[model samples]
Target: MSNEKITIAKRIAKELKDGDVVNLGIGLPTLVANYLPDDVDIVIHSENGILGVDAAPDKSLVDKDLVNAGGSHVSTKHGACFFDSSISFGIIRGGHVDVAVLGALQVDKNGNLASHKVPGKMIPGMGGAMDLATGAKRIIIATLHTNNGSPKILNELTLPVTAINVVKTIVTEKAVIEVTPEGLLLKEIAADTTVEEVQSLTEAPLIVSPDLKSFDVAA
Candidate 1:
């Protein structure tokens, strides 16, 4: 898992396209902002009611009232707008967002995501996951392939679901998988990971790419 976090972050970042409206969920999903290419004109959305969000702010520039959904202070571009949560969800449910990057505790073979609550642990609320999961045109899940050395990409989710069949891609430290009609397809794997190793971690059957190749950080 060398540079595992960075690797996962970069993998999600690469999926962004120009002019895309994106909502980056708390935690790992937020890292995508730091990696957006200069040429891309993607706009960031914050469910707390901000649009055209900027990258992380410097400590000196942090504003108590200007924060992302994760509660971290964030800066905004010149044209960014602040609105009510109701309007924000309208934009989400109205299908205005082109993509949503989410972090999941578990994602099953069918693209069901469990991020709201993991049984047996009291935690923060689900936040905007429900709206973002079903509303966004595309859902990209950014997470570790496993937790506590156990696979999180499962045959069936153990926790309650946030969304069903909403995931378009799964980016992890070990591999990248896309949800296809046939099933989850193994698009790529980390340089040192083997197909057998990845297969062992995934509960769903993995279909290796015909030209299967190793994963690498974009230069």
Candidate 2:
């Protein structure tokens, strides 16, 4: 792959608008902060306790108490504020976040997302994902086109759902798919990927834009 995680993150950062309050989920979601438009006043929120958080920190300056929910040390820009978990979740539940970018294990055709435990594997339970998905003005899922080369989008999710009909768009290495009442719409495809390649990985039928242009994620 082409360091797909970085490709997905860079594209997502470009989609953000100015002055948006964004909450980034643990892993890939956190990478968005590093690529956001420096000119835009985008404020990042972490579910654990930090709001207006900064990007990844230098390992030498790690602060145990300034970690995100994923246990990764986080820095902060000037004017960043700290609050309790209860307050952070309240912002999510109260719909204060403009966008929430989350990493998902699976996303169904109906825009339902499954990010928690699997039947055979134990993992961290859903913490603020449910709240962020349901309450954010926009929910963006960042994940690979596949897991171990197997599709992650399914006809029906095998795991418990975090939010139903809440995902607005999915950003993957190969394409950017929008969730609509009809089906997944192929909004854009990476420069190196073909429509056929995207179709091969999509569990549902994909709709191609008549004016679709080649996607250079870095462009």
Candidate 3:
């Protein structure tokens, strides 16, 4: 994985608290599982009918039938359970999940998310994302600051929206942003990144947090 992706994953991992039940979306969101602190105890839920997700297993230990939402082979934490998708989604739609970390194609200033569709690009289909977006108590976005130099954070969404006004926080390689009723707030910036660099890559105006601090992966 690229450093940018690892940085974003590690930053999002810090948001996971003890006793939290988190559903991780495919791609970068799945990487958050690897960075979760050793002291933190939380259940990792995969929509594909597994809970208590553990780290990726050694190749020799890989279980073909045991995979995450991204279809990557993974180990299970002690006491993990399995069920049908119906029951898994029931846990999600029932608002039992504490947090949902998702990826986005675009997230507008209003916290609207666009992740499933990319215009004419063929997609398998919107999977459990729509349900997770609305079902989770807290929604966090983990994505690149830009896509091929184009800002993913925008004043208005140009792609199909996954859920409107659902995202609470966004973690990118350059910064950590919070979406509030007022607007987007730049809460933290990467140690190597400058505030101006982050602003230049973001289409939406940012309100820099008074308590803004440099992002450290070790923290």
Residue 57's lDDT in candidate 1: 87
Model 2 has a clash total of: 0
Residue pairs whose backbone atoms clash in candidate 3: none
Query: What lDDT would candidate 2 get against the real structure?
Result: 0.86
Clashes of each: 0, 0, 0
How high is the lDDT of residue 167 in model 3? 94
lDDT of model 1, residue 153: 91
lDDT of 3: 0.92
In the range 36-137, model 2's lDDT, one tens digit per residue, is 787877988888887888866899888878877778777888999999988988888888899999989899889999987786686676777788888998
Q: Pick the candidate with the highest lDDT.
A: 3
lDDT of 1: 0.88
List where candidate 2 sits over 4 angstroms from the true fold.
Answer: 56-64
Off by over 4 Å in 1: none
Clashing pairs in 1: none
Models sorted by lDDT, best on top: 3, 1, 2
User: Would you list the C-alpha lDDT of every candidate in the order shown?
Assistant: 0.88, 0.86, 0.92
List the candidate 3 regions with Cα displacement exceeding 4 Å: none
